[model samples]
Target: MSQRQRYAIIGTGALGGLYGAMLARGGHEVHFLLRSDFDHVTKHGLKIESHLGDFELSSVNTHATVDSMPACDVTIVALKTTQNRLLEELLTSPTRDGGVVLVLQNGLDVEADSAAVVGADRVLGGTCFLCTNKVGPGHIRHIDYGRIVFGNYSGALSPAAVRIAEEMVTAGIDANATDDLLLTRWRKLMWNIPFNGLSVALDATTKQLVDDPHAVALIEKIIQEVHGAAAASGIEIPETMIDKTIDSTRTMIPYDSSMRIDYLNRRPMEIEAIFGNPLRAAKKVGAEMPRVEMLYQQLKFIEAMRCDTC
Candidate 1:
């Protein structure tokens, strides 16, 4: 077992709640910065339903804001990228000097934005391959898979990244550490770009998307575009990865993507981080992705419509 470290979870959503609950159950000191569910979680604690098993923390260290939380050894920033503008205050407030800020959100180049607030040396990018969701307040349903890949954002082997991975592994998560941050981001985006965007655009599940012939063809085009973008950015993602992702999704439980779920619930989706940013990056490097560009424009329209109604 690894030594237990103090951990703080900002944005107690599906990702944050699941990982933080696992850590707290493993005997780590886990504090949660919650907004609406602070009272319910503080009273009823956190409940996790996983295929691995089910567990409930009768009580956890909970706070409504970062100011009320204590400095911790590592802070997991799991907030959706849509809420990233709030990260400066959330990260710098309760994170101690030299404390690790593990960014466990989705999208490309996300770590750089957070690293701007927390030092690059203190930021570690994390990619989660978990199928999980917050079924209700203080409750999470882990559908399947819970592996994490962490990378040093400072271009070196980060001691903080290694230690944080140890803690995650100790808590029964499949965790690994890497030295290449940009490559990690690009690789994760390979899966995120096609599945997430198409899921929203088509209003379909993973199985539904893969089951359609036209959808399958469109998915490949998006993957190839992402491959080109990654190569132009000086990161090479194998073309074989596209087939592997398709094969894996065929076996996955029919699931609505995060973007699709967000759109259904009328919450803001992560259009800019996942599509707009990557599209702009590819364009800057002279990579043309007409399909991806079309998807970006459509998402932008949906987002604008949502905001106008608000």
Candidate 2:
């Protein structure tokens, strides 16, 4: 990859739209794969209102299908894990150009899926600490933190990873390449397994969950359970990270997590990807995540019931 590489954003929702628009704004050639927003974004382009700044692209290169999109150097998979079944087709479009595929979704072993399609050498997994919402067609509202930590799924850092992170930094994103991809993933899960699960299971915002004594206790237990699983998997998360995740959420703006939003809209939340995968991984490693299991069960039940009115 060059200093200015051609990029394709596979899922142009909140994450893709915001980061892809930022890349375009930073003067990179970005192609967006949009569905419902294809016509809207083609005409109106993309819009992002962020704490860092506000910007819009009046003329965006948009595509409605993977076959229609041109080959690019970096293809970002921002689709929800629920839509991962569509990845093999979408990724082939960019990998044909001999570019790397970055899996920018949540949960463990996500990159493995991408690696299976594109080969591990060409696959990178990124963890996003970004808070954003697609407020309208071609519009994204940035709420809080917007940092991305990415690493090669096959182990060891590569020059491409470094260059890509540097390019994103130039694009004004807090991006870094980590040498330990799996361990970094475990770190990310420290926050995600609890918050994303509870947000849907408890039907509570980050603030509300952290504010209530009972919720906070449950949240802590879930976090510890996740940490235990990580340890069982041979990746030991630092002790201090537990407190940091809690403090950061307590101070950040109150917000509804992505899973919560999915539930509220009656869309399928990432239950299997976020919870099922980790639990099974833990079980294989002989680790029992009773609290995390409870939370996962609660979310599964809520997922079954949240659509009762439908």
Candidate 3:
């Protein structure tokens, strides 16, 4: 393979920890910029358990803040959508230079937001297709398939993006760089928007949501609305593709959506990033999306409830 490049993971949670650990174990120089959990992670390294297998790294580099991070070739940002502002601060800090920020976030607008801070040339778009969770400090549980679709949003295929994808594949993580990164992000959001919100609203698993005929039809309606909104915005998502996506989810392990997990734990929800954006896009293009609007409002109300409880 190519010479091992220096890399850093900005968020040491489920997705970050799993990918970072695998890359480090493959002998790449890897570092992590974490928050308050740095001490525990440093002392014990990262532990990953998956249906594929389980493993632990004996020594993994970690820092609590960006001020302490060393210059690296690339930084994979696995932060939640709500933490985008904080990520902007970290990316703009002098500690990062001559490096690309690969965003492994859930939503679609991260590329534009990151471009505002670090310029479009330094930002790469990526979407992770996996079901994993940080079960505890230093422990991550991988629930299903792991794949990454990434590329430069400006349409210029950068050498860095290609190299990163190669390294990830070499480390046993399925990854590919695409010229149509925006479509990939939108496709992932199509699944995340309805299922995530409905799961939170009903306190159900993916299987539970699909099993209820009424809930299943509701999800299909939401998908149709999203498909319409996307087409209106000049992003054409075929109707048949939606059915294929739902079929893919059926094979995934029965698990609670991230939104439900966050709600149960009283953490901030990503309603705005996931649901609100598409609705706004629909409005921008003069498309009506009443069902999407309703779901978005419901998720917003849920967010307000969580805040009030806090």
**What are the TM-scores, per candidate, against the unseen true structure?**
0.96, 0.96, 0.95
For model 2, residues 154-176, the per-residue Cα lDDT tens digits are 86998889988999999999999
Please write out the lDDT profile of model 1 over residues 114-175, one tens digit for every residue. Answer: 88998887888888988998998899999989888988777787777787888788898888
Ranking by TM-score: 2, 1, 3
RMSD of 3: 1.7
Specify the poorest-scoring 10-residue window by lDDT in model 2.
301-310
Model 1 residue 303 distance off true place after TM-score fit, in angstroms: 2.1
lDDT of each: 0.87, 0.89, 0.82
Supply the TM-score for candidate 3: 0.95
Error of 2 at 90 (Å): 1.1
The order by descending lDDT is: 2, 1, 3
TM-score of 1: 0.96
- Candidate closest to the true structure, highest lDDT: 2
RMSD to the true structure for each prediction, in A, is 1.5, 1.7, 1.7
